[model samples]
Target: MDWVFLSELAINGALTGLLYSLFAIGLVLIYKASSVPNLAQGGLTMVGAYVVLALSHDAGLPLWLAIPLAAVIMFGLGFGIERVALRRLAGRPVIMILMLTLGLDIFLRGTTLAIWGGTSRSIELGVSYEPLFLGDLFISRIHLVGAGVAVALFVAFMLFFRTRTGIKLRAIADDYMASWSVGISVEHGVGLSWALASVVAVATGVIWGEIQGVDQALSLLLLKGLTVAVLGGLDSILGAIVAGIILGVIENVGAEFLDPLVGGGSRELIVAAVLILTVMIRPHGLFGRHDIERV
Candidate 1:
């Protein structure tokens, strides 16, 4: 445990956390609006990454163009899911809804596998860059770019929520019937939220693919995103952001400092432990509202 090593670990953790936030925030948005976690979130992220790889790497489209195209496709996918899948199950039991999303996750995974053939791919942004050297620590240009993009997106989303449509979405999240009475289309709001969530998923996919190669296993990586969302408080978008950063930092630091002593792969165990403790101690989550059951 050198102090310098600890400092580097902390920095790495923060970067990882920001990336986690990008994924988790989308989960929170969908959960807040629809009151059901989209289990397909992970698969959606994988699809986005594969779309980018296919368009940019295989098809020779520029990264800039391919990224946005993947986002648009994901947006359509989200809208389609809402219209064709989720809409049919509205007002269903929570368990039933969860199962529906699980089924969706399987479907999306199969679709990706069929199209992508389970091969790993990587993207080259083609930008020549150098690391930012800070005495004994070095931060890669790519991580810095990823963190900046994540923060910018987070701020932009906050601002968007201040608009009228954002207000309506929040209202729908609070009470669909009340929003409907006020002329807000609940279905539209749900569709919008899903679309927004899909965009976020695309952003996360791009960043993750840059950090690690695009692969079929990208969805499995979303277990981290799911953990961040649950720990942060499923309904709180800001909480997801904050918690994602915290989890990222903790995981990085733990893996760097504690791995030698405790053994590798324990970092994931730590995340799972934290999630369990947080859920048991605060069922609603760190920033989640407490549910009040009324008879």
Candidate 2:
């Protein structure tokens, strides 16, 4: 076994995992704020990418301008979903909430289809795809940039949680009834979470769009995000980061070694296996807090 090849795979996988974490963090944010694992995150990501594509490519706006605008637009869309739809189901059953998100996912996908159609479109985010060689190993410039962006945004969000609004959001997450008693608006807090999630989705979509083009298949990233969210604990941001890297490395290395033996498609299999194992062994995830309910 060549160690150089293994090292290369590991490095690339780690970078890919950071990207996955970026997407999965959106799910964590939603779950943390509302106890809802947003099933429509993938659709938001796909539509957000197309929105950026439209603004930059079709509308002739510069890439920088288009991205921020797309983020704002997606933010509003998310807020609307929570306020108009999710708000109506405030005390609904778990199954109903899940189904609502699933329905939202379908609605988002349909909207994308109606506007952008089903064809894939290449998007230019002004990131060069040139490979940077480090002695015997090489890495894509875009991947490095994307990973850096992910880390930076993650840090920024962590800091945001220190502000007044962030504190309110955190309080609401801790106990909705308690928060309301203290005059903290649970509705606004939850809506803000959805908006932020959509903003994060835009960033995830743009980075991925640059790598794979804007297409319907980009929505498949929802599964990757879901896998990471579950493995990391739906409400734990740090867990998402760690789980993403673990999954990323496993995907690259496992696929390389096991694909030939399994006749291919081991990448997805590895993800599924890890997810299953995490659910079975540690239902709350590596860093998730296990709830202790009073009878």
Q: Which model scores highest in lDDT?
A: 2
The alpha-carbon deviation from the true structure for residue 5 of candidate 2, after best TM-score superposition, in angstroms, is 1.0
Error of 2 at 288 (Å): 1.1
- TM-score of each model, paired residue for residue: 0.93, 0.96
Q: Model 1, 85: alpha-carbon shift in Å?
A: 0.5
Candidate 1: where are CA atoms >4 Å away?
Answer: 127-130, 292-295
What would the per-residue lDDT of candidate 2 be over residues 1-295, giving only the tens digit for each residue? Answer: 7999999999999999989999998998888888888998999999899999889888999988999999999999888988899888875676898899899889889989999898888877667767889899988888888888878877877778788998788777778789889898888888999999999999999999989988888888988888899998888888888888889999998899999999999898898898888889999988787887989
Model 1, residue 136: distance off in Å is 2.6
Per-residue C-alpha lDDT of model 1 across residues 1-295, encoded as one tens digit per residue = 7888788878878888878888887887888787888787888888888888888878989888999998998899888888998787766677887898788778888988888787777767653457788899977677777778778887887788789988788787788778878898888888888888888888888888877877777787667888888888888878877887889788888777678987788888878877888878877778887777899
lDDT agreement of model 1 with the native? 0.82
How many backbone clashes does every candidate have? 0, 0
Q: After superposition, how far is residue 87 of candidate 2 from its true place, in Å?
A: 0.8
Q: Pick by TM-score: which candidate is best?
A: 2
| Cα lDDT, all candidates | 0.82, 0.88
